[model samples]
Every structure is written in C-alpha cells, then in structure tokens.
Target: MTAIILAGGKSRRMGFNKAFLPYGDKTFIEHQIARLNKIFDEIILSANDARLYAHLNLPIVSDILPERGPLSGICAGLIRSTSFHSFVIACDMPFIHEKIILYLREQIGGYDVVVPQTSRGLEPLHAFYSRNCIQPMYRCLNEGRLRIIDFFSEVKVKIVDEQEFKELDVPTQPLVNLNTPEEYQKYCDYKAPNQRES
Candidate 1:
C-alpha cells in the first residue's frame, strides 16, 4: 500500500509550517515518513508547495482542485496512487500510531474508506481511502461539498470505534494533532530528552 501525507495545509492556526516543525527526533513530516516506511514502500506527499518538500525525494502532488482543503489533497493522492488503496495521514498529527494504521489496513477488505471514530469524531485524515473513491470525492469537491464525510454516504465506510483505537494505540495518544502554538509546545515538551535523531 502507498502512504499519502497531506502537507499542504496553510497552518493558519499554528501560525507557521507545522510540517517542518521538529518532533521527537525529526521534523513532523520526517517522523510520519519514518513510521510509515516500515509498512509501505511507496510514500507520496500531497502539497501545493512542491519546492518545500523537494529534498524528501518522493513523489509530490499538488491538488488538482486548488484551495479545496484536505479533500482536494485526498483526491490528488488517490488519483496518483498506484495501489488500490492508500493510507492517508495529515502532517500535523505527530502521534499517529503504527499499530492503528496496520489494524486499519487489515480492515480495508471491501470498503472505500476505513476511518476511525473517536470522541474526537471521524478521522478521515488518518484513514485508508481506496482509489475507488476518486469519483465520489471529485463529485464532492466539484459540488463545493468540501467536508470529507459528506461523500461517505455514496461509498462503503468502516468506522473503527474509540475502544478499538484505544486498544491499538499503546501510548494512548494517537490522533493528537498540533493545530496551535500551545499544543505544539506541549507536544515538544512531552518528548523525552533522550529522543535524539537516529
């Protein structure tokens, strides 16, 4: 399976490029790639700012429909992916759990989207989306229905519940996203001092 990292967000809330922010031992983007590399050989980054990620040396895709939010990035990645399904994760979610991702991949037997639903609500960014969803996703984007979940009714969705998420995320901090400076600082302080670059 291919892993698609959505790194194109404007980061209005975070006030800077959250993708390049330092995490545990690397940038947030690098951390995600390190974790996903263990499972997927092909990883793609979806972003409009191709120059920013050029050094990563991976396939970088710009949204086919510009300024359409995460849905646009999803559509672009799904279209570019060679696999039947691609695991999608946002750049700011530093606490994404590999076990949860592996579990979600195992559950993608016959669904167009396999997303986890916590008390935090539906997590489409950290979900598996099949290329089969390209058409519906485009329809939603073109119709100005930018909400990722808005197109779910037209496709098969497997919702992983909060209990399942908790069981898989051993650190119990999966899906923790840094959308603000305070959240970013807290995450930075939470990492161990010994967590140096490998």
Candidate 2:
C-alpha cells in the first residue's frame, strides 16, 4: 500500500505552513514521513507546488484539478499511486498512530474506503482509499462538489466508529490535528512535559 500526504492547503488559519511546524525533534511533515516510512514502501506527497517539498525526495504529485481542496489532492494522489490502495492523511496530523494505520489497512478488504468516524464526524483525510474511489472523486471534482465525503455514497464505505476504536485499544488522539496557532501551542506545551520526562 502507498501512503499519501496532503500538504497543499493554503493554511490561511495557521498563518504559515503547518507541515513545517515544529513537533518534538522533527517538523510535522518530517515526523509523518518517519512514521509512515515504517509501514509503506511507497509514499506520495500531494502538494500544489512540488518545489516546496522537493527536498523531501519522495514522489510529489500536484493536484490534477488545482485549488479544489483535499478532494483534488486525494484524486491526484490516487492517480499517481503505484499500489491499488493508499492511505491518505493531511500534513498537520502528527499524532496518527502506526497501529491505527495497520488497523485501517486490515479493514479495507471488500471496501473502497475505510474511514473513521469521530464525534466530530467523518475524518476523510485520515482514511484509506482504493483505486475504486478515483472515478467518483473525479465526478465530485468536475461537479464542483469539493467536500471530501461527497462521493462516499458512490463507494463501499466502512466507517470505523469510536466504540470500535475503544475495543481495539486505539487511542483517538491520533485523529487530532493542529489547525491554529493556539492548538499548535497547546501541542507544544503538552509535549514539553513529556519531552522533559524522557
């Protein structure tokens, strides 16, 4: 399976690139690369400007349908993926656990998508996608339906709920992503005490 990282967001709320934000000893994107490296042999970065992440040395793919939000990025990543299935995630979600990734992979059988449902609703970015999703995704994009979940009805979706997460001992913190400076600061503050203890 391939791992796709979406890093093309304008980050208007963050005021800067969230991928470069510091997270412990590494930046957010760097940490995600490190974690995903352990599971996937092929990883694709979905970004608008390939030049910005050229230094990372991974296969970078720009949105085929530019500026169409993450749905476009996901479509582009799926098109470029060497594997039949790819794990798609946003750049700011640094806390994604490897175990949860493995768990999601296990659940992808017979389903075009295996997304998690938190109290906050469906986490499309933190989900698994099979090549089967490509067509519906394109349909959504061409119709200007930019919402990630807009095409879910066209695919076989397996939603892993919070109850299932608890039964598997999977921590939901992995779903947490930094979107604002205040959230980033809180992450840093939370990590400081743990870093000191280590």
Q: Whose TM-score is greatest here?
A: 2
Please report the TM-score between candidate 2 and the true structure. Answer: 0.94
lDDT of 2: 0.88
lDDT by residue (1-198, candidate 2, tens digit) is 799999999999999999999887888899889889889989999998889999999999999798799999999999999999899999989886877888889998899999999999999989999999999999999999999999999999999986777776656777888889998887754432112332
RMSD of each: 2.3, 2.4
lDDT (tens digit, per residue) of candidate 1 on 121-164:
98888899998889999999999999999899999999988687
Candidate 1, poorest ten consecutive residues by summed lDDT:
189-198
Clashing pairs in 1: none
TM-score on alpha carbons, each prediction:
0.93, 0.94
Error of 2 at 117 (Å): 0.5
Question: Model 2 misses residue 51 by how many Å?
Answer: 1.3
